[model samples]
Target chain A: MSDQEKEVTIYDIANKLNISAATVSRGLKDHPAINKNTKKKILAAAAEMGYRSNSFASNLRKKSSHIIGVIVPRLNSSFMSDVIAGIEKVVNEANYNLFISQSLESMKKEVSNAKAMFNNRVDGLMVSLAYDTSDIAHFESFINRGIPLVFFDRIYEHEKCPSIYINNYKAAYDITSHLIEQGCKRIAHISGNQLRNVYAERTRGYQQALKDNHVPFDDTLLIINDLSARAGNEAANQLLNLPVRPDGVFVANDICAISCMQAMKKQDIKIPDDIAFAGFNNDPTSCVIEPNLTTIDYKGYEMGETAARIMINHLVNNDDLQKTQSLILRSELIIRESSLKKGSKT
Target chain B: MSDQEKEVTIYDIANKLNISAATVSRGLKDHPAINKNTKKKILAAAAEMGYRSNSFASNLRKKSSHIIGVIVPRLNSSFMSDVIAGIEKVVNEANYNLFISQSLESMKKEVSNAKAMFNNRVDGLMVSLAYDTSDIAHFESFINRGIPLVFFDRIYEHEKCPSIYINNYKAAYDITSHLIEQGCKRIAHISGNQLRNVYAERTRGYQQALKDNHVPFDDTLLIINDLSARAGNEAANQLLNLPVRPDGVFVANDICAISCMQAMKKQDIKIPDDIAFAGFNNDPTSCVIEPNLTTIDYKGYEMGETAARIMINHLVNNDDLQKTQSLILRSELIIRESSLKKGSKT
Candidate 1:
């Protein structure tokens, strides 16, 4: 043979092995329909012949990049970090890369990020909506492209995109119900961006928990803000000045819980004595705080891994993603010192 | 001019405006040289004539996806989160997406992430070296392709790629010097992954401070490990058990410092009274920690903003990026109760 090179194609491999080109192509892509033994042989042969048909090249031919564009609310939060970690783990292993963008909690930035991702022509998308992201129209490009899409945490009520998240309402309900069982009649709630479904669901759970116990739910007890440490300090100050103070308090996050705890300590408001306290997202900061915060553990890492795994699994391994819908991960309520009014764990 | 079409080239703009095509191209790229007024006029005329040219498209044009891959050590840490946030912010603003992959603090994972990103056909790249990343050849693809690449904290040495970060050495030195000034005779130092420049720089700064202060630096005073909270607790135990205990402690990061403080508190080690302390990074936990932690305020949000700005500035503005090598932002020492030994502010 001459030194001139002839590029190896699936047809060449198929003809050499007396198999159909379609079967050879499927085997190259690691499709389960083709037996593993045959797939291995074809891959070895393709490698030997320097066959150039690979995932990226194949994706290009199909005009799709096997990439998922993800826009998050923010990057610095513990919960958000955990979620991204999970997503990175799964997506990396699946041979897909996560194009992560942060909105910095701005709806305008979120829209622009979506437009950029759309222009890049990603095969699919995963997103945790930004605070005050009301319009779903920015996501129409992905929907129009018929790309596989998944939303986690800060999700919307979009019918087109499937979502994966914990049952926030149920998780909150369980925590509130437990607080009621601890003989808390008058409860104070500190909530975050109520515009998002996560906080809204938790709020609903808090109200339902109060109503279920036949306690008159008072709107005056609800203190909503940015739910930052500063906000938590302010909330503590407001609670201390109330004419009828609450017997129990539920903070939406550990940062707020810790801040409130510090403020209460300064005011000599003993935890589990004057007011039983509970927080959400069992962040490590919860353990550092005095009396240790009791909280609902939202598994952000698990959420991220599940989202990436589901998105890539459908794109690469399975084809049932469009038919598959919502996935709800279970959340747990961890009981700790701050909420142990009846007596603590030894 | 024909109404059907009015042709314009870089030279046409250069000639019409009595400048070189190179100047015209630079102006179009938002170069520092081109005045804003001149750029606005050129862009207006170009838009009117249906001008379409991509700065990135002129590069080798490898039909690869316009994905700028990033490899961070871990996503959970506040510092890494800030750095990644900066990179993402900039990449998104430039209509380029970031394929974010974490090394999970292992060299093995870092290598794997690099492979995945490279295979993903990332057009350009950015990376913060992992705990033990000894290899640079792994980034050969981008380097060989003449693609713009940048590195930030936990960076590689003697590499030509542009880097964005604050001076870890100076920040560490300043904090150590502050502790020495506060009458700390025997100061214990908490270090991180010594293989990485960040922790190594901290150790060097600590020793340098001791030498500069006429205090004999002891090898026994240095504690090295992954600068996490768990590691800090272990270091705290070691320090507490010392025959001649240190009068002060300087932890490499805020999370570790807070954990060390809590551990010391459990042992009833009165902060600032018995042992003055300083931590790195002014995280929210630093403020929430009892007595408040005296720390080096490393702004994660600002770092992200700055990092993104530098990257986008280079990508969108000038191709003479070799002229722009590195950027180091300023950090300040925020004194609080933990390091207030001699009638200092709490």
Candidate 2:
């Protein structure tokens, strides 16, 4: 490339300062044997020559890049962004740089990102699996090579890989039970692809809650899609068109739930009185919507921190990754007006 | 480093396949000189041996990392997250990896992140300046070296660095003028740190709009803060405590504007009838909020794609960075019920 300039090396600094290359190298590394005055002069000459230390070359020999690679399904969500921010804070404080990429909810992109991270020789890898990542064969390379790998949020169960996530099953169960308590006999559910453990577990929880509450399990009430805002709108329309509409609805995420609620409202359906609502991932929009969305309040920042801490412990503290196979963070059912049925106990 | 295993090199794969190391390397690289059967055999053996190609070492010699570094003020915002998603898409499509970092709106963190990107030897850097970044000295090294650097959104003016942004000045002016035309004689403007050009230009635009409408500028009506939700609430309280409340309020961001409106609404103020509202960024919450919010609709994804394209063009195509020093993207005024005065023309 025309803009490419010749890289400045220690030899150039040595030549500029009329010193031996060995001495220049020792000074640049701040070796104890190097004289203080010579070291200062060598540093000054190195800066003047615009010599950037070859960390990549040295890291190759050391077998440690001091770089953490993060792959998420997407970055446009408030929860994911919060998670990233938390990871960034911890990673930065530990003096490790981050290489972040998104899978865009595609397993194909996830594989390519994993390959790139592996080729780049990241010290450790953190991932939130994509929607359709049925098999994690792409991450086998990291495992075979003993490179630390940690999964967060939408995770996979692997003997070698430690995962950090909230109890999606129990959270869904609690929210569903809450809806049942609000006198909802028939509750609709909106979820994402069942290939993802998060969505699958949530579905199981919803089914279990209905069974425990003595509510009949209706397969027709369960709408499965990508759980996008558009999907939520479609799901809402589908539910509204049904002969007997549900009295309550629980969505996999707040974005979709809010959109679903908006669509229902456009049809002149009243919230809570008409159909109580609950969603997961208490995103920022949960409160902005009229009547406010009742959702699961799980801290993405905490999840990110926990996952990064696990990676750091394995990479820095030499902690055994196998010792911590899975960690479940706390999640709460945040009751809001959207799910509060009229005349129900406060 | 007990978990650290011996790196499987080309020699290991060659030894396993009883082939020359040179042949193995060529086969792995898909060299046309190598037989297809030999290439397939080499790949299988490499995978079996868990051999990862050392791109970092090769990049060190080539003076190209095939990595693009991105630093933004923060990642938690919907706008920023969208921008990151867009950047990731383009960078991945171009077969380049992204090293992403957030400054958290702190100049100190921005400088440190810049240093990390520099040390990591990224081929190009994309940045959105931090809130308190008073100087561009940290970026001097990138400019000094022939590394292509591009800025987007919250940008800085530099002869060497190309920037991609929307016309914040005109967007702000248009929205302010729209409010003025709705008979809002006394309008308040909420802004952010003046050190950043986006906020400064917006403030200037608001002021010029008022002047053009023959409305006297009131310094007391101006509120400058971080433009966070909490700050917006505080600004609302401050405005309410004023001797005279503004007929309309324009916030530099949607999160703050939504929060400000919510705070005012809680105090028994009727929106549009009592005080018209307008915001920038057109965040998702803007639509979810009651009455909807009048705002500037600028595509963060488009801005991100433009910035990444610029960096890729310079790094991959050998295009002159100076040729596209500043690129202004399109933005529109989205008028909604929040800014529509009663009895005004539809």
Candidate 3:
């Protein structure tokens, strides 16, 4: 609320300099594209009008650190890195600092990271939940303090906070239906912790698709783990040992799916004939792998860009944060060699 | 320094509570492992002793915001993500924030990022240079203010700053030597921007290895580019069209090398039989790629951990950072089937 009262805005400085607010904002940050003289003029006007001192004084008084905290389950993945790249681009342009912490996929660490962010007084928070994070009690501190919180990708449903994600349920449904259309009678699903909505929704979609196609739902066909490479390899080994081998596998992620495919290949299984595979997240590995994995294109960078846009709007302008309850980006099944039972369609 | 003049440390609280410094620190942080009664007692003791207010006052005077800035060429690479993972682990443990930015391999962007980090007044800075960032002028502000600056991986020589890196020259030499021993008479080098010391050193080593093996260094054998996937593909195509096709190829990094190998495979070239390959960084892709690419292990995680430890030590205890001026981590060749020309050696 203090930001709404007696604070300097870029528009004020722009008006004084007879330039656009965009130019003023860029100039203040010393953006390289902005001419040096224009930047100097904007800086001089900002200082002369006491905007810098006033903003700094208010910031000190309110302890508004102008730092945004990001808490993710892990940062080593390609998808997470792409998301972070998009976030850093937007936040850095706005002259705000990003403080990143990883949960390493542990709920305890996630809670600790949230507490750390709260103690540090981050202006806003972005989160992607850990696999085992069932409780939302830890994030109450941010909600209670009215500090903006936004969730992306692997999110928990909170009434007050907004989330950015793709339509995982629909993506899974489409991929499973495609697999069935390709003549897969028995399909196996490899999933992550079913506690998380992302994996749970995908499972629901997979089951629904199977039922729609008049296939019997078999509990034995569903495999659950952390979606690790070892889990995938072990699942593949189990599938091979089964009396009726699964003709198709729809994995939760590309890494696990590729690992499983590789394991099966080592056993001399012919891809797209003896078995077919579909993966989620369309990771770079999906393309590099032999047979080119069929996958759902999860737009991580776009999701990140959207989340940062919403958070920055809420932070800078104090805009209504809930105009859009949920922003679900488009996701589609990308047909590739791995899942083409007969021949390449495209 | 003001921090030394009148600051209340965890040691003071620990002494008052008759506890270890670690317990006082963990208790104040609400660490889950500490019992509720112990944490409550430590909180009460700290409040009674005026440690909180005293420390806050000292922090204000010293302008210690407890944030560290990291500037890297890019973040999407597996090596970079690993490094960031290690840095986040250590800094988060010490309760320091990390502000990460990417230069996108542009010197102009690197300068801008450095300026932004300086303006944000990060307590310390960690940098991995962009390809063309030849000057240290942008970093003078941090050096002038006596802020601790540490460079890792793609670093430039600077007298005031400490650097952490693996021996790229030795790694490249060893890989090239192995290729020569594998009966590859004509070896090609696919390099990144020569402006970067990482690539430059590798180029030097490559030339030296060829000379050491009694093979004349041919200028035409070296291909230089930005090392993108497309670059790798195009370079492979060019290699095929060369007057004398190379029997082996040594790429600077795994992504490009894998891409090049894949491209070569599309042309029906037999790996390790017709043309052997070796790459750097031991990227996860290297293992996934067919024939399990022979590469150099770069140890990005360890490098990141070491850099963060040095920065935290200098920032927190004001320790003698100069004692360990430059830390060079270990690197070695990892031989796999991709370059095993004479079959299994081990």
lDDT per residue for candidate 1 within B289-316, as digits (tens), equals: 7768999887766766665665566656
Candidates 2 and 3 compared: the better one by lDDT is: 2
Local accuracy of candidate 3 as per-residue lDDT tens digits, B1-346? 2332233568988887789999988888899989999999998786554343333234445667678899998887899999999999999899888889999888999998887776566789999999888788888767766678899998877777888998888889999999998888899999988888899999999989999889988878899998888888999999999999999999999889989999999999999889999999988788888878999998888899999999999888878767677899999889999999855355
In model 3 chain B, the worst 10-residue window by lDDT is: B50-59
DockQ ranking from best candidate downward: 2, 3, 1
Which parts of model 3 are misplaced by more than 4 Å?
Answer: A1-58, A343-346, B1-58, B342-346
Top DockQ model: 2
Per-candidate TM-scores read 0.80, 0.97, 0.85
The number of clashing residue pairs in model 1 is 1
Candidate 1 residue B189 C-alpha distance from true site, Å:
1.2
Model 2 misplacement above 4 A = A1-4, A15-44, B1-4
Query: Which prediction has more favorable lDDT, 1 or 2?
Result: 2
> Which of 2 and 3 is the better model by TM-score?
2
Candidate 1 structure quality by residue, lDDT tens digits, A165-280 = 88888878888887777778888999988889889999999898888789888888998888888898999999989999998898877888788888888899988878889999
lDDT tens per residue, model 3, A1-346: 2332234567889998899999988887789999999999998887554343333224546656678899998888989998998898888787777889999999999998887786666789999999899888888767765778899988888888998998889999999999999989899999999888899999999999999999887788899988988988999999999988999999999989999999999999999888999999988888888889999998777887889989999888878777767889998889999999875354
User: Model 3: DockQ against the native?
Assistant: 0.28
Ranked by TM-score from best down, the candidates are 2, 3, 1
lDDT of 2 by residue, A158-226 (tens): 999998998999999999999999999999999999988899999999999999999999999999998
In candidate 1, position A255 carries an lDDT of 83
Clashing pairs in 1: B86-B304
DockQ-wise, the better of 1 and 2 is 2
